[model samples]
Target: MLATTIYEQGDHRWIMFGRDPDKAEGIIDTNQYLVISGEEAILLDPGGIELFAPMLSAVLKYVPADQIRYLFASHQDPDIISSLGLWDQALPNASLYSPWLWEGFIRHFGMERIRYCAIPDEGLNLTVGRIQLQFVPAHYLHSSGNFHVYDPKAKILMSGDVGAALEPGEPPLWVENMSQHSAHMKTFHQRWMPSNEAKDHWLRRVRQLDIDIMAPQHGRLFKQAHVDEFFNWFEQLSVGIALR
Candidate 1:
């Protein structure tokens, strides 16, 4: 199904679209994000080849395809990068923004299509008119060459699949129940994060941030209350203090 929703929170607007939330197993029904700034327009995690047309169509409502300045991928997953080739062709002038480690991975797909601007371990900064972006590092959340994005201005953390929630059809954009979302979050972390040490490190690193929104790829956009409550539970689960 084609589920799309547009939200305007304060100064920024978000256009979100993807497959039904509940079908998220080993599947890549992840939602793609479109971050528009005064000077630039960017598409985040534009994967899932099927969603490209709608993603662009949704984007066309705001700006021209050529106006896109950047494509940001939190990691190198097929659902995240598969359609990048199409984007590369569409936005010939736009450049890809990703973690440096993903440099080879993006090239592995085919380098001539787009220009890659690899970010560092700590993160990189991007400017869209006056808005600045800080790419926060969440090493090995689901992959070694992974990272998270923090938009201080928007108080958003586009945290890949680390804090995801899957519900069959049309899952709510932001989960309201910390307990319910907590279960799905736990299963994902435990199965994907096999190294306890790395998990702990990523947890502590994340805790250092002052977040108001935890926008994961799969679930509801956890707002302030749920952010604090969910993190508290996630911290416990990460430390192995809880079980299935």
Candidate 2:
């Protein structure tokens, strides 16, 4: 697994971990994010159970396990939070912030030690160290109940699967060119994303924010002009083709 610091300023920083070369074949690749502000840190979409060992090992290089006070899951997908049980053991006192609608379902992954702070459908705000993170509602873009993290201070949006891709093998961490990268993302979005109405709402909400970087839970990061390019492309693409 590779760990890269996507952003940093003072004690506030963002680290992205992914591109596991030794990962077992047949499993889809995933990206996990860590946001640290002073003493507290939050892990986002920490990946599946199979990725637990390497993900934990990579995270330890930056912050101690105990310092990870919070865990955020965009939805109840297995690849997104199946490692909940292992994480409960690792961060015994940490709390998980996830969709309230899936509390019952997510608990099946195991939640004896860690507290579950269900995020209401309207979403909510959380403060860690010096930064305030907003859990923005993003329902039906793929899942019945989902949310994405937005950091006003950093001008970054941890956009879950909104801009995800299914690129094969190892790819660069950042998207230097959208023309080449959009193809990898196109099919994934049209198939997995199920609601055009949901997509449009999310686009409007995000456009209001001054985003500098849009980081998804899979593939490369979108920055600067590429971020705008993503918005333009996604706004026009007609998703939920399976239903058609």
Candidate 3:
């Protein structure tokens, strides 16, 4: 697993972990993020069971296990938070932030120690130390109750699956060309993201924010210019076309 610091300023930092060359052959590549503010930290989409050991090892290098005060799951997908059981044991007092709709279902993974912080459908603001994080509603972009985290300080929007791309092997961390990257993202969005109305709604909401980086769970990150380009392209995309 590769751990790269994508953003850092003052006491806040964002680290992205992905592109594990040793990852299992059949497992889809996934990116996990860690956000740190002062002494508190949060893990985003901690990943599946197979990745738990490496993920934890990678995370401990920057922040101690006890400093992980929270875990954010964009949705209830196994790839998103299946490491809940291990995390439960590792950070006994940390809280899990996720959509209220999937609390019961996600708990099946494990919840013996960590408390669940259920986010409302309209989303909410959470504070870690001095930094305030916004949980923005992104419902039906793919999941029934999905949310993306927006950090005003870092100007980063942790977009979950909204901008995900499918690619073989390890790819560069950030998108350099909009036209070339579109090919990687197009089919995934068309097939996985089911509703055009929802897609439009999410895009409009995201456009209102001052985003410097658009970080997805499965593909290259989009920075500055690429962020706007992706938003423009996705806004015009025709999703839910697979059935036709």
* TM-score of every candidate: 0.87, 0.98, 0.99
Cα misplacement distance, residue 167 of candidate 1 (Å): 2.4
Candidate 2's error at 20, in angstroms?
1.0
- How should the candidates be ordered by lDDT, best one leading? 3, 2, 1
Candidate with more favorable, higher lDDT: 1 or 2: 2
Q: Estimate candidate 3's RMSD in Å.
A: 0.7
lDDT of 2 by residue, 1-244 (tens): 8889989999999999998888888888999999999999999999999999999999999998888999999999999999999998999999999999999999999999999999999999999989999999999868999999999999999999999989886788889888899899999999999999999999998999999999999889998778989999999999999978
Q: For residues 77-164, what per-residue lDDT tens digits would candidate 3 score against the true structure?
A: 9999998998999999999999999999999999899999999999999998779999999999789999999999999999999889
Q: What is the C-alpha RMSD of each candidate to the true structure, in Å?
A: 3.4, 0.8, 0.7
Looking at model 3, residue 37 earns an lDDT score of 97
lDDT of each: 0.72, 0.94, 0.94
Off by over 4 Å in 3: none
Span of 10 residues, lowest total lDDT, candidate 1: 1-10
